[model samples]
Structure formats: C-alpha cells, structure tokens
Target: MLPISYSSLNNSRVNRDGSSRYRRFIPEYFRRIFHYPQMDIEYTFWIMFYLCFNPSRVYKITYWHKQTKNQWARDDPAFVAICVFFMAIASMSYAIAFHYLSFFHIIKTIFWAVCVDFISLGLVVATVGWWVTNKFLRVSAHNHSVDQNVEWLYAFDIHCNSFFPLFIILYVIQFFLLPILLSSSFLSTFLSNSLYFIAFVYYYYITFLGYNALPFLQHTVAFLYPIILIFTFYVLGVVLNINFTISIMRFYFGQ
Candidate 1:
C-alpha cells in the first residue's frame, strides 16, 4: 500500500485522475472557464480572469500552493493564441473606430502588438524565469523533474498561458475602458482612472502569483520577478519601436 501525501489529497479536486488539469484546446478551455464549483469555486481559465482582476486572488494563489503543492503552471498554447488574437483585434478595432489607422496600419499594429507585446515579451520573461527557477529554486519532483528543467519552451508555454488573463483585461481596457476615459464627465473620469488603477494592481499582483506558480521559487522572488520583467518588456518595447503611449494617443486624438 502506498501512502498518500497531504498535498495530493488536497489537489484531488483538480488532479482527481492523476492527470494534468491544464487544457490545450481553446474551445474547451473557454467552455470550462464558466463552470465553477457551486460552493468552493473551481479555478478555471475564465475564472482566472476575474481572479486576476481581484487583488485578493494573490492570497488564493498562495493558499492554493499550500493545499495542492502543484506549482507547475498550466501550458495552454491555444488559449494564449486566442487571447493574443483578441487583443490585436481589439486594438485594431479601436484604432479603426477613431479613424487613426488604415487597414495597412492595422496590420502592422497587430503584428507589432502580437509579436512584440505578447510573443516576444512572453518568451523573454519565461526564459528568464526558467533560468532563475532552474538555478535557484528547489522544485518538487511532482511539479517538475531535472529532465524537464531544460525545457525552456515548456516554461514559455506556461508564461504564455499566464498572459491569457492579462490579455483579456487588456482587451476590455482597449475596447471599453479607454472610451470611458475619453468621456469628459467627472464620474466617467473618476471611474476610468479607478478601474485602470485596479487593473494595474491586479495585473502585477496576478503576475506575481504566476511567477510563484513556477515550482519552488520563494514567494518574494516570485513577487519581484514580474516587476523586473515589466521594465524588461518596456525596454524591449522601445527597441521594437512600440510606444504604448503614442499608440493610445493616436486612438484618443485620431491622429
């Protein structure tokens, strides 16, 4: 008879069949996101969006880590690709609505946003994250093995999936929140800023949880990794000639 670990016992909810809980198909992932446990609240991809929005989700992630001891993050490429596509479409739509971008400009903008913002940035951060984890962290064998440590592509996929929730929020901001900010009314202005601030905090906080989702990295290191990557991505943005401010201003002023 084998002994059951406390962690395995707790994760029975997600790992009931001793299989990966991550979904790879976009349709299934989206479909599954809506169904939560009636009382306990199962964390699905869609639910992760709301959770990512809430600052309190950090505690949830921490608690989840404690309960499941499952730190290997989900690696869902289809979902990540869909999020990237939606973000590009939303930005392009916003630009077209304001008459700021031609179809050709839209194509270029989409390429830059998808290639630089999502794919390239995700790769850089994930690669760095994997290096850090492989070097410094004491990962669990159940989470990842030494052989898996060299699989930077797997790390990249995990980070890409992690970007899904943030991308969804960005889509909302691009399509709806920016328009609200454009409103000259006092209430709109207040609400827009407040929402943006909330989203900003939530994005970083969830990203912190994501870094921790890499097995065995200290929580503090997890918290700091995302902050550093934000700066790194900004630098990459400049190198790629992608100015988020200028793009938004173009949308705002229809320049």
Candidate 2:
C-alpha cells in the first residue's frame, strides 16, 4: 500500500515495474533517490508504474523489500530537506572541530582542501538560492498564467537543454586540459583530484548498487575517504620535505 501522503495522488504498487536494476534487492533507495522528479511529472501519479504489475504493502512491510523501498522513498524532497539540514550542522561541526579546537593536527594541505570544498558548496547554494528567489519574485499572472503553454511557463527550458552539454565540454577541458595546464604550466601534481574522484565514484557506486564486496569494504570506504586526503598529503610532505608546505599552499590557492 502507498503512504498516506502519496496515496491521494493515485500511486500504484511500488514494485510493479520490473525494469529497475535494483528491483530485486534495493528498489526503495533507488526509487526514492532517482524516481521522484521524473515520476511526479511524467507518470499518472502512479508511483509503481516503474516497477511490478502488482503492488505490495510498502509502508507496513519490514523485510528487505520494504526496507529498501522505504529507503528509496526517503529520497523525496520532503526527506532530503531534513537530511541536508543535518548535513549543514555536521559541516559546521567540522569547522568548529578543525578550525577552533586545538585537537588533531590537521595538515595545512588538508585544511586548504576543506576550504576549497566549502567555497564550492557555498557557491552552489548561493547561485541556486538567487535563481529560485528571482524566479518567484518575477512571477505574475501573465508570466505564470495557467492558460499559457508549459514551454512558455518554463522559460528556463533552453537553459536546461544546454546545461548538460556545457558541463560535458567544461569537464572535458578540465579533465583533459586542466591537468596538462596545471602540470606543465603550474608544475603541480593531481593528487587531490585523483583521491576525491575515487571517493566520488565509490560513493555513487554504493548509492546505486550498494556494496557487493567483502564485509569490510563498506566500512573501509566510509573511513578511507577523509583519511585518503590526509594520507596523500602526508606522503607529499614526506617526499617534498620542507617544500611540501609551500607547494600545497600554492596548489590550494591557485585552485
């Protein structure tokens, strides 16, 4: 059965569709994380249209199927907002612990990496915030008229169409060109890029497929991501001796 929040919207069996790769084991997480915006717009309010023909009791069931299904549903914006709130709190805690407390000896290199990460995340939040605020501030009966075509309703359409291609081009330039430019021009190594990319792909794989490795792989990855940065910087420090500090500062600043 559907949750009460979505039941009124005419949801179907959560597992009726069989095409999802995670259907057999972890449908819930995959559904919640990846399904919502797409289903909300394109389907007939039929949540399970992507799954099996016959629906099961997604809310009441407590076994693997229901657990996974619930995990998926939690990706809805309603739940994500709560998760992000906690994540914000955690980020603040990290700042307090690393920047304020005189506890662990956070290498100067990792400290700068965290700053870069915070700045990037800050810009994402700011730009999205401005766009959303401006969008609503400009709303008018004529602009958002119910009678108008959706194409006209969402003038952001053309921008969306171009976003992916632009991202691809920039990524190609960054991935292929940035390294060459940085290595040859700036005389820097790509250590941070490599470590973070591993963490990213690992996180995505786990989010999509879950861990299929030995019992410790999940735990290892969970702990290794941050430690990887620390360890990488430590190695550089050992290799470069006294020059490591200056080089790392330059890399972080130039980045």
Off by over 4 Å in 1: 1-76, 139-151, 183-193, 219-247, 250-255
Span of ten consecutive residues with least summed lDDT in model 1: 36-45
Candidate number of the best lDDT: 1
Q: Give one digit per residue, the lDDT tens place, for model 1 in 114-182.
A: 888778888897788678667766454663544334246546654554565556555565456565555
TM-score of 1: 0.54
* lDDT measured at residue 174 in model 2 versus the true structure, 0 to 100: 35
Q: Write the per-residue lDDT of candidate 2 for residues 165-186, one digit (tens) a residue.
A: 2222222233344334345222
- Please report how far candidate 1 places residue 254 from its true position, in Å: 6.8
**Candidate 1 clashing pairs, residues 3+ apart or interchain:** none
